[model samples]
Target: MVKNQPCIEIFEIFTAKRLHWVVKDKGESWTGQYFRDIILTERVFPFLKNEENVIDPDEVIFINDKAPCMRAY
Candidate 1:
């Protein structure tokens, strides 16, 4: 018998009147390295860099909810 049910992590970003969705791959979990390397580096940073998404990249702020992966380190 399985002790745990299957699940995936997903989140959404708010851009003024726009909404952007981000979902992790199936069977994968969010880890500190993955968060630093992939999510922040590959995905989030690029999105923030785009002028269409942000007017001033440096002025953008992040408010962490103290996620497990973030505290994992």
Candidate 2:
């Protein structure tokens, strides 16, 4: 029953005012490096920079639930 299934992964980033997402390329794995490079550096940072008001990085807070792939060594 799995033969016709399409392979895709959805990644999302949300703020109080904005939401951003990307669909993974076929066969790409959701590794920690991928999260940092594609999700954080590519999508999230660009979105923050385009907002009308300036946002200080030091004042921002990030909360995570300790997902295995998201932990930093």
- Runs of candidate 1 with Cα error greater than 4 angstroms are 1-3, 67-73
lDDT of 1 by residue, 1-73 (tens): 7778776677556655355666776766688787777777677666765667866665665544664322111
Query: Which stretch of 10 consecutive residues in model 1 shows the poorest summed lDDT?
Result: 64-73
TM-score for each candidate, following the candidate numbering: 0.66, 0.58
lDDT, candidate 1, at 60: 62
* lDDT computed for candidate 2: 0.61
lDDT per residue for candidate 2 within 1-73, as digits (tens), equals 7786877678766666667677886776789898779766776666655544225543454544564433111
Q: Which candidate leads in TM-score? A: 1
Question: Whole-model Cα lDDT per candidate?
Answer: 0.62, 0.61
